[model samples]
Target chain A: MKLKVFLAVFACKLTIKLLRLLGRGGTAIPGKIALRICPDLLFQLAKDVKCVVVTGTNGKTTSSRIIEEIYVKAEASYFANRSGANLINGITSIFIENSTLTGKPKKENAVIECDEAASKEVCRLINPAVVLVTNVFRDQLDRYGEVSGTLENILIGIKNSPRAVVCLNSDCSLTASIAEQIPNRVIFYGVDVPIYKNPVSEVSDAPHCIKCKHEYEYSYRTFGHLGGFCCPDCGYKRPEPQVSVTDILSTELSFTKVRVQVFGEDDVITINLPGGYNIYNAVGALAVSEAVGFRRMLAKDAIASFTCGFGRMEEFDLGGHSARIILVKNPAGANQVLNYLAGLSAETVFVCCLNDNSADGKDVSWVWDANFEKLADMSELIPEIYVSGIRSGDMAVRLKYAGIDEDKLRIFDDYDELIDAMKNQSLPVIIMPTYTAMMDLRAKMSTAFGGKEFWE
Target chain B: MKLSICHLYPDVLNLYGDTGNIICLKKRLEWRGIDTEVTLLPIGANADLSRFDLFFIGGGQDFEQEVLLTDLHGGKDKEILAAVEDEKVFLCICGGYQMMGQYYLTHTGQQCDYIGALKLHTVGSDVRMIGNYMFKCAEESSGSTIVGFENHSGRTYLGEGVSPLGTVLHGFGNNGEDHTEGARFKNVFGAYCHGPMLPKNPEFADLILQTALSRRYPGTVLPPLGDGLEINAHDHMADRMEKQ
Candidate 1:
């Protein structure tokens, strides 16, 4: 039976490889075929490679990418699904991609970034040594329910893997408020920047509290709701962080000097990724690396060299016009984009597109919470704006309430019309779009203007 | 007449663009020459509740709802409630709607009592009521589909004989118990219809303004429908029929 299963798995890979060569949806093809044939193929195949899994509501993709790169430098020989295939089938496809003809994986470690709700199935298949939880927010409410309920799902995976968990401490109150009910190795990482403004990473969850049934009092807001916070009521405060973001400065467009807290001293870690938000993600990667036995020095060296991964904080030049594409999936991310744009004096029009895709969170209502209206000064900075998406009118209303002059806003539901307006208009465009909408816009632009390499 | 619209903790519950309701109301009222000013009441600070002709609250997490509840519970909000009962218009949604009620029971089984404005009780923490919710005013000829998402665990229950905000056309609006989601108290408007409640349905927003206006200016009649009102009303009625 085992021999038959292994052969079937191997044959399925051939189909996936052929499909991949054809430039179709190749990643999940082989895995789905094999899994359909032999349900237990995942457990059998991952026997040799040590697996390290990362799952959370946000930052899993970026955190896993950084960890994968760290292993790449370690030259331990690893296989990773780099294209953000986070679901059960997605991880299976990754396992198939790196498997041998004899159904053997060719890596020392197979680090996977699994989807938050799908972590249970993956853990059941291959028990991992380390799991990194980034943070939880009220994201994709239509599909994922609430943050607390999603936390329950994450708790399942955490219990499944009891050996190690490098949990983000900045949100310890939220993720760790429930830790007493569960048992695991919980390590935390975050930045401790106060009395200054972060030029790059501006999006964070700042108002959540511990136990007082009130908003957490923050000494400072890092981005979204990640910060040092104490409940104003019963004095439930932020957990003392194990690792703190000591010092960070956005040195240039795609580079920054960030000092991270190690054993007892502040060590300077340089990174070549733009935006302060990426630095926070880098903070998560480093903390998880230290917990998983990767030396801080080696991890820093590997990370600082990273130019861009996935599609965040990535810059592309379509033509005479250059566009910086950042996935503005939530208010926290949108705030960071505004923060980055606020610093730039160049005449730039923000092209914000909103779609109620499941991946982008079906609730477009969260835009009101984003603080765009308060950044009305940005409207004056970049006068011409193109609001286009499934919920373009919604975005326009938000911008208007944020004190943005209503006259400055031009609404477009059609991507083609919006992109044409963008291309024809002389000013630089900051393309802040959500989920599949970003991909849709990217496809239209790339098809019209050669390919993605032009943006790079 | 300078009508002050107090945007309750506009910094906090503003998370879901719930404040867009304020923007919609303000713009429509202003367009009709009604002097409307939306003010953000800072936490613990006193703004003369008597001065405002209307009140607006958005949505937030249970904790945030508690924070605003605490601040408002201790303050002169009793007078604000009086202001509404004494004939001021009010509109609240989601967390805002939740906070205006008598009490909210969190999923963890803890109860946070809110400002005594609406006779509604909310039980939070547990399975959140999510997905796209459609709202059809029970007796009204027109309807609106709130095309956003919901992520709250607290199930709400209206007091006996109290009217619910609207009937659910799409999702589980007020938990599994009541398909009749949200609450409506006199001139006080509250609901879980947090699709910014207004931008998607401009006519509905105009109704809110018009209601507030008849209170402020008892004699003036509403102007003719313009822009997308007719088309939106048609689409909305079609939606209800499709649901039926």
Candidate 2:
């Protein structure tokens, strides 16, 4: 290795240690500083490791965790980016931390979760053995522009890694379209049956066909635009998935039992997480593991026992009352959360925290697209709705327009007061927070209550 | 009183929660005991545009805008022009606002034909002027400060025939080169604001409703509903923008 490479690695290592000592969890700065010294540090560090990169709008972190669980089950030596640091700089920091000062990778295997916008460069540098795209949705309009723009970014990333086997969600028309253009070996995973019992009328991010502008007709829809989509005019349709959820045997708040078909073989799997999106994540994880040449039974076992980390339906106890924090960034994801909320039979306290910070997309207008009006139908079950965060006023007005009674809406600008207000509530509480608000509130919740810090 | 709203290209030009403007308009009207009907006019939908009291068109992606341009050129452009001439209240936002002009010159120098309902034109740029923006309405006696989020690359310029909707108070509006934010030709209102441009600004929503109502029932006065929550929300956003 050159003197600059050695010095970059040493500096990155020292910065990580210093940050840990200071109780500050930041991977981007160290990786940035190291890259400033040596521009190709990540390429040098990640070149030797066999990586499986996960990139999509939603379920990236959760899918990465599930994939990591499979690696653990197989007893493979691997390191994954666990704390939501999926950007280029943060991902570079992970590679540096998992490698030696001589620029040799310490781990033989790596599972990387990459941001959609940064995936093109990351994939080109990492050159992963397998790339899993969970699904695509309208996410962070201010940051990513449009859903098609986001899809284009991911497509560019996949194009860079022609050798990598691409695992895609067939249900997502945007994701499935990648298979048609790329020469890479593609495997698809999706729910074969409709997840919802009732008909849904939510907005579709990909309403029109990707190939043509013709409207898509769905045989059955799982959620927002993810379904058995086919264009009448262009003849473009959903591809048959190799790994598919053939049937949802049972679904509960805690877990879901599904019959999954893996490469012509059928197996009844229990996804430890709830919701239909998690099932998609589970299937995508299995497809990626299978693409990476891992055993099907190991992937199934890992998914069956895996528990998700911070803010992806993370449960917490708020002074005797149970609260669940679900991080919502976009309309599609927020709609799914609202759909989950609409299914509850018991009365609950619903809290919506919206922030316009850089990480949270800066535009609070997406709250309107999220069909919060569905909550108005279940007004009896959801007694009170609390709007918090920096843009709580905007959220409060949004909920009011959604037919939520003005009497039911309360604004909590202060986090301490918001936490205190929910502490003594007897009913189950569901807290939906955007990215930045979730980070800040999760820290406060961890500090007040007993929970693991994000970096820990 | 009844107001018929034609939501143009709801399937294509519905970005950044632009449907929220329609929702706000509908709810605010319903609250005041006014009956309203909203019809979605997607591409290829042939509707008598002059029959509707109000016409609403929201923003869309660049690709979707291109799709909309084809349909507008097909025949809807003439109908929309007729509606504008008939004094039907029209609120077009962002891409929809851009389409109201004669043409849009894209960043790649490609010229896309538009509806030509207003005397305005746009030139697309590589850099998008995005953020929370505030502007004071320029119309006489309507000094209300409008607050909304603008995310657009198309810098629009008003011609001699049309007047600007508002003067920029805080953020970049319209071309970023001028203080003008949006264009106005009679009752037709076009702007880049899409918080969907009305939910936070109740006065603007009511103004659209009142304008539509007056067109049908001349000398009609709209009764004021409780606007405490709406005003609070509007003030909060305006204050945040002013502080920045």
Candidate 3:
């Protein structure tokens, strides 16, 4: 190794140790320092390690965790960035921390969740063995500019990794279109059957055909713009998936049982995560595992027992009241959370924390697109609605306009007061926070309740 | 009194929660005991534009805008221009705002013809002007400060015949260099604000509603509903932007 590489590794390792000692779990700064020392350190370290990269607007962290679970189940030596640090810097930090002093990777395998915008640079450096795109949706419009712009970024990322086998969500019209352009070997995975009996009309991100301007016709819609989409004019239809969820047996608040078919065989798997979106995640995870040559049974076992990382339906005990935190960043993801909320049988205190922080998409207008109007139907189950975060006033206005009773809308800008307000509640509390709000609120919740720090 | 709302190109140009503006208008009208009917007029949908009192057109991606341009050329542009001439209440935002202009010049210098309903034209820029912004409405528009989040690469310029909808108080509006935020010709309103530009700004929503209502029922005055929550939301955003 060069002197610069050795120095970069040493400096990065020291920073990680110091951060841990100081009880500050920051992944970006350490890697940033190391990169400044040795610009090619990540490429040098990641060259030998087999990596599976997950990138998309949503389900990236969950899909990464599910792949991590497969690695754990198979007893494969691997390291993953599990603390919601998916950027190039944060991912570089993970690689540096997992490497030996001489800059050799400690593990032969790795799972990385990459941000949509940062995926191109990260993929170019890592040159992953398997690249899984969960799905694309209109996310953080101010940051991405447009959903098509986001898709272009991911496409560029895929183009950079020619050797990597691309695993895609065929149900997503935007995601599936990548197969038409890229030269990489592709494996498609999606839900074959409709996830909902009565699907609500959603404002689709890709209503017009990706290839042609004609509107798409769906045989069945799973959620949002995902489904058996076919452009009548262009003949651009959903490609047949090699790995698919044949049926959704049952769905509950905590878990969902699905009959998934992989490699011409069907297995009734219990996805520890709930919602129709998780089913897609499970299938995408399976596709990645299969592409990476993991045994089907081991991947199935991992799927059945997989637990989500922080803030992706992360549950906690708030002084005896059950509190579940669902991180929502975009309309499609938020709609799924709202769908989950509408399905709850018992009365609950619904909390929506919105922030205009950069990571949370400074434009909070997406709250309106999330179909919060669905809460009107669940007024009986959702008795109290708590709106908190920097943009709590905006969220409160959105909820009120969504037909939520003004009497139930409560604004709590302070997280401590918000948590205190929910402490005595006997009803289950569902907290839907945007990305930045989730990080801050999760820290506060963990500090009060005493849970594992995110880094650990 | 009942009013008909024509939501133009909902499937194509419905980005950044622009649908919220329609929802706000519908609910606000219902709250005041006014019956309202909203009709979605997507591309290829042949509907008589004369029947609708108010029309809404939202922003879309560049690709969608190209597709919309092709579809609009098939008589919809003429219908929209005629509607604007008749002083129909039209609310166009971002991409929709650009489409109401004489033409849109892309960053690459590709000019696309629009409806020519307003004496304005948009020029695409490499840098997207994005952030929370506050603008003071023109004197004719109640002069209230309207707060919204704008995300657009198009720099729109008002021509001699057109008047500005508002003056920029904070952040970039229309073009980054100009103080003008939007274009207004008769009852047609076009702006870059798409915090959907309605739910938080009750006055603007009411302005559109009142414009549509008065056109149908001559000399009718709209009764004021409770606007405390709406005003608070609007003020909170305006204050936040001002501080920034």
Each prediction's TM-score versus the true structure: 0.83, 0.98, 0.99
Interface RMSD of each: 4.5, 1.0, 1.0
> Tens digits of per-residue lDDT for model 3 on A1-456?
588888999999999999889989999999999999999899999999999999998899899999999999999999999888889889989999999878889999999999999999999999999999999999988888788889999999999998999999999999999998998999999999999765555888889898987899999899999999999998999999999999889998888999988978988999998887899888999999899998998888898898888998888997667899998999998899888876778889999999998999899888878888888888888889999999888888898888888999988879999989989778889999998899898999998887678887
**Candidate 2 structure quality by residue, lDDT tens digits, B55-141:** 999988766665777888888889888889888899999988998999999888899888888989999899989999999997541
**In Å, what is the interface RMSD of model 1?**
4.5
Q: Which consecutive 10 residues in model 2 chain B have the weakest lDDT in total?
A: B136-145
Q: Per-residue lDDT tens digits of candidate 3, residues B26-62? A: 8898888899999998888889999999999998887
lDDT of 2 by residue, A194-226 (tens): 987853468788888888888899998999999
TM-score between candidate 1 and the true structure:
0.83
lDDT-superior candidate, 1 or 3: 3
| Tens-digit lDDT string for candidate 1 (B98-194) | 7778888766777777777878888875566766566676554135444444556778889865687677766777766668877777777777776
RMSD of each: 4.7, 1.2, 1.1
Ranked candidates, highest DockQ first:
2, 3, 1
Worst 10 residues of 3 chain A by lDDT: A196-205
Whole-model lDDT values for every prediction? 0.69, 0.89, 0.90
